[model samples]
Target: MIEFLNPAELPRARAAGALVAGILRTLRGRCAVGTNLRDVDRWAQAMITEAGAQSCYVDYEPSFGRGPFGHYICTSVNDAVLHGRPYDYTLADGDLLTLDLAVAKGGVVADSAVSFIVGGSNPPESVAMISATERALSAGIAAAGPGARIGDISHAIGSVLRDAGYPINTEFGGHGVGSTMHQDPHVPNTGRPGRGYTLRPGLLLALEPWVMADTATLVTDADGWTLRSATGCRTAHSEHTIAITDGGAEILTLPPA
Candidate 1:
């Protein structure tokens, strides 16, 4: 379902967005070498509960995933990319970790993701992958505005990834988000401009640009939720929830100081 927030509802949406961003930043700061994946999940759950917010992922049972995800946050390391279920793995230096989070507060939902290296390890390839996704995400946000077509955003995102020598995957991409976590208007990472759904004020979209280093194919882990690169190549993902407004697109999810 596609949802457009009324002016009054936009404030609630922004609040939800801020909560999600702050939680992500806090969790990211706590992550380091030897930190257990379950620890991250625990931190997220506690923070959500303290904020009186609801997790959009925990107990989530989408058709494509195993029932009841049972995790507060997605902790994807190295080869893992999307829908990564927290496990017993301890982070190591130079591990590329992606944290994707969504939460509901005040009847509104916001979703966002960030990719970064753990333990101060600065692998060149990992940095490149993360930077590429960030660049693509920025491009997509820049292309979004009232009256702009979804294809324009997708095209802008795809151009960055393609120019960086990464393959594109369309099976999973960004989408409309509001009171519900995932909604209509699937925004592919790559597409032709001037096509697809037209943007309008009050529309909220989660624009994510993700890529695997070598291939566009994906493989599901034994856990039935974690999506990894088919070639075991390192991957990165960047996302932000944006609202179309009278002036332009307003990014709702940004890490707080």
Candidate 2:
């Protein structure tokens, strides 16, 4: 379902967005080479509980995933990309990590994801992949606003990823978010411009741009949640929840200045 937030509910949306952003920021800071994926999930739970907010993922039961994800955050490392459930693995130097989070507060929901490298070792390929996704996410956000078609955002994102020489995957992409997570208007990573749903005020979209280093194919881990590259190539993902506004797209999931 496609859900839009009225002006009265905008504040709640912002609050939820801020909470999600803050938690992600904190978790990112705590991650290190020796950090355990399960520890990361524990930190997320603590932060979400302290904020008096709900974790949209903990009890999430989407058809594509195993019922009740039972995790507070998604900790994707190295080859893993999307829907990475927390596990017993400990991060290693130069490991590319992606943290995707969603939280609900005041009856509104916000989602965001970030990719970064653990330790001081920054592999050139990993760095470039992460940068590409971030740039694609920015491009997608820049293309969004009132009257803009969803395709415009998709095209803008795809252009950046393609230019960076990464394969795009449309199997799972961005989507609308409001009272609940994962709403309508599937925003693919790549598409033609001037097509698809038109943007309007009050609309909230989680625009994510993810890419695999070598191929577009994905393989689900035995856990039935973690999506990894078919070739075991490193991957990266970047995302943010944006609100369509009168001026332009307002990024809701940004850490406070």
Candidate 3:
């Protein structure tokens, strides 16, 4: 379902978005070499509960995933990319970790993801991949505004990734989000401009740009939720929830200082 938040509802959406962003920031700060994945999940759970927010993933059971994800946050390290279920693995220096989070507050839901390297180890390839996704995400957001089409956003995002020499995957991408975690208007990472749904005020969209280093193919881990690169190459993902307004797109998810 596609949801458009009226002016009055936008504030609630922003609040949820802020909470999601803050949780991710907190988690990222706490993550380091020797930190357990379960520890990250627990931190997320604590913050969400303290904020009186609901997790969109904890009890999530979709056809593509195992029932009841049973995790507060998605902790994907190195090869793992999307839907990464928290496990017993401890983070290592230079490990590329992606934290994806979603939360519902005041009846509105917001989703966002961030990819960063754990500890002080900076692998050039890993850093490049993560930077590429963030740049692609920024490009997509720049193209979002009233009268714009979803394809425009997708094209902008795809161009960035392609130019960076990364393969694109369309099976899972951004979508309309508000009140619920995922909604209609699937925003592929790549698409032709001047196509798809036209942007309008009050429309909320989650613009995510993710890519694999070598191939576009993905393999599901034994856990049935974590999606990893088919070639086992490092990956990166960046996302944010934005609200379309008369002026342009307003980014709702930003980490607090």
TM-scores for every predicted model: 0.99, 0.99, 0.99
* Candidate 1: clashing pairs of residues: none
Give candidate 2 misplaced runs (Cα > 4 Å): none
Predicted candidate 3 versus true structure: per-residue lDDT over 77-156, tens digit per residue: 98999999999999999999999999999998899999999999899999999999999999999999999999999999
Which regions of candidate 3 fall more than 4 Å away from where they truly are? none
Highest lDDT scorer: 1
Q: Residue 200 in candidate 1 has what lDDT?
A: 98
What's model 3's TM-score?
0.99
What shift in Å separates residue 47 of candidate 2 from its native position after superposition? 0.6
Q: Give candidate 1's error at residue 133 in angstroms.
A: 0.5
Write model 1 residue lDDT over 1-257, tens digit each, in one string: 89998888899988999999999999999999999999999999999999999999988999999778999999999999999999999999999999999999999899999999998769998899999999999999999999999999999999999999999999999999988999999999999999999999999999999999999999999999999999999999999999999899999998875
Decide which is better by lDDT, 1 or 2: 1
Each model's total of backbone clashes: 0, 0, 0
